[model samples]
Target: MGNIQKITPNFWFDNQAEEAAQFYTSIFDDSEIVKVSRYLNEGQEIHGQSEGAVMTVDFKLNGQKFVALNGGPQFKFNEAISFIVHCATQEEVDYYWDKLSEGGDESAQQCGWLKDKFGVSWQIIPDILPELLSSSDRDKSEKVMKEMLQMKKIDINLLKEVDQA
Candidate 1:
């Protein structure tokens, strides 16, 4: 097979690497476990234990490759970086928003920004966002964006109304 493209997001869990992977994959469609590689006898050890348990897990979500690690809790997911998913329709937006926000906090913002239980942030934006933002009318676009910034989970209809005004 050709070189498979992957967007690996390393997670440092205390000991919940596998559980986190299963929980995440189960929440998305077309997602499944790809591979699980535990620590080998020759690998480095942590806390006097050799061969780190659940060293890495390769998984896919909606066809996107992601790798999870059971590294120690030296770091955690923050709001600095987030995944932005462009939805073609309101239905798609709702589906992702609801699913992703199940055990996470929903933030208020134009477009879409939500934080899952894992504290990993995501932006579920509409495909039409670019179109609206790039419109010739800067004032209208700004208005639409401002309106979006104040709400949680983008509403395409509201944005369209703002665009028309």
Candidate 2:
């Protein structure tokens, strides 16, 4: 037939695929759970998940397709990969940062990055972040980068203010 219709990012969880997908779809707009499939005896020999247990959850977050797999805990989520929540305003950034950081590792928060309770890293960033950090004026961009390094959630106003300084 045709080429691959979509590229779905798969998330591996330790029996928390359903929970993580629900939480993610709830946070983002225009998102929803498409379907869920439970484990069967087909390949339980390796997975070890009991029958009827969650196997996969297909979902959409902010209109992006994703799949959550209830894989065992042989692997862990680390900072190597992170989802970026781009916002147009400070309020949007704050809202996402608050929700994503809830029940998360507070110590892991830095430079607009935080790990959610499920250990998934997220970057709550302003839409103009790139422009601010790549401004024609080196001083402005450098200062913005420096200021950003000291904060947990991104501070759009602070970045703008520092840009002028």
Candidate 3:
């Protein structure tokens, strides 16, 4: 058998499991759609999905496994849960922020957080963000925090400037 992940995040979509999976795979490297399962006649009454409709999509994004389910509109994504994308450089943060925020809700963006078209929340942050925000120097940390709060996309250079100021 292939390797199995102990825990996997399942994304609920309103009939867009396949589409969401494809979109995510396209944005990240080393990503691919692993399997697609179709709804069957047996569960048609409860699921309300056509027998041939895509029911679930198993995919991997940069080696992390995930499941996208066409589970209808009973639930929606919120900021309470978010995927954090740690980046080593501003270029990486910019790349991920732009790609993930395309077609997403602009009003939902703040402090490096964005909601994708699928309503999934993502945080595109620099690897040094945690360090800067939790520094021993209260003034430097507070300055960095203020700058970060003002940004929709994280600016590594601006955060670093807090140290010199």
Candidate 4:
């Protein structure tokens, strides 16, 4: 495959590269697995993976490119890095939140941020959030900010009502 994207995010997994790629592809529209590569005996001493085992998976989600690597447990994903999903409507927000957060870390959920079962952090935000939070009217912005801080998943209707109030 050609390097169409200048930069691509690579996810390092202990051994779930293919699984995670499949899960992510299933959650988004216009997504699919592009290619998969297996470990070769030449790197057995360094990678410590069995021959022919999954080593990397190339995939696309809604046109965004990503790579998943079976890099072992030397490192792990954290909240410091997260993928943001911007939703145009409440239904869109709800759909992504419910699907991505399944079997995920519930305690990490706050202000529309969640950690999936694979420990990858994600922020599910409304498209109007920036406008609401950055409005010139401090009163409206403050109300939205306060309400947002108290939410695990953003309630667009409540935010809108609070903004109007």
Candidate 5:
């Protein structure tokens, strides 16, 4: 049996927590919605409006916990921090790249870095990155790095080819 655990990430949305959660869960495997609680009647009122509404939501993405809060339009997702998906083949890279890039912008970088439509950054990298970095040939490693810097989704075969050259 699976052990009891907690996986949580706090996400601020402009009244789109549910929508975003559903969208995210749809894109990933081994993910599902855990619970959603809307506002209820609390004896207190602020500005003639209910003080609490959708205080919190718990969802899971690939066994990771994420908490979505209906915090007003105070902050938004940026590229400062991003989720990295390590892939072993071009097929894996293509799958994630196509899925996440939907309704999002794409920026190419060395290794891997791309900004999705929601302004959230993602790095779709290959499993061979470490191998290339630790190669004995500094020139080949440098070349691989230079080539990677120009790509959004890392291509493992391409990196290997660069390393060989």
Candidate 6:
């Protein structure tokens, strides 16, 4: 915990940096808001945001460093980059899926992936997914993949059942 992170993931949000940081910190354990900065006459004309408005929020999610920037809407979050939450249990998956997907675009959810209210994409995947998918049995892995593709929230129990089928 004392060592500094080498590379931090930065998220660009359209005026929701503080809110998003708070939301994420509240959901994750050992998380906290470290600092916050405001825009003060820097790139004002291009950014088009008011002075003194929140420009950045530095936070930690489960002890991992992350930055949330209040950048303008020049860029939008897409499937190009997403954070995958590797859950060890079905309960963890359910909790994260339910919490992150609240007030988010439900229709965008597919294969344990969903876009949060702030438009950030997240994958609430179970830890057993990769193990089962990489199994030597092609038929079972294929069935697991097939079932995964058809569901919004992943059903680990169903995947396990199909893996043994």
Q: Best candidate, lDDT-wise? A: 4
Better of 3 and 5 by lDDT: 3
Report the candidate with higher TM-score, 4 versus 6. Answer: 4
- Reference-based TM-score, model 3: 0.97
Off by over 4 Å in 5: 1-7, 41-55, 107-111
TM-score, per-candidate, Cα-based: 0.85, 0.94, 0.97, 0.98, 0.84, 0.94
lDDT, candidates in the order shown: 0.80, 0.92, 0.94, 0.97, 0.76, 0.93
TM-score of 5: 0.84
Error of 5 at 41 (Å): 4.2
Worst ten in a row by lDDT for model 4: 1-10
lDDT of 3 by residue, 62-137 (tens): 9999999999999999999999998999999999999999999999999999999999999998999999999999
TM-score of 2: 0.94
Q: Name the regions of candidate 6 deviating beyond 4 angstroms.
A: none
Model 2: weakest 10-residue lDDT segment is: 1-10
Indicate whether candidate 1 or candidate 6 has the larger TM-score. Answer: 6
Predicted structure 5: clash tally: 6
Q: Tens-digit lDDT track for model 1 on 116-137?
A: 7777788999999889988899
- Residue 14 of model 5 has an lDDT of 66
Per-residue accuracy of model 4 over 36-99 as CA lDDT, tens digit each: 9999999799999999999999999999999999999999999999999999999999999999
Tell me the tens digit of each residue's lDDT in model 5 across 1-165: 877565456887767788778888888889888899776676335323255556567888888888887766779888777888888788888888888778876443435777766666788877889889778888988998898877767778888899988
Off by over 4 Å in 2: 1-5
Candidate 4 residue 26 Cα shift, in angstroms, is: 0.4
Per candidate, the number of residue pairs that clash is 2, 0, 0, 0, 6, 0
Please state every model's RMSD to the true fold in angstroms.
2.5, 1.6, 0.8, 1.0, 3.1, 1.7
Where is model 1 more than 4 Å wrong at Cα?
A: 40-52, 107-111
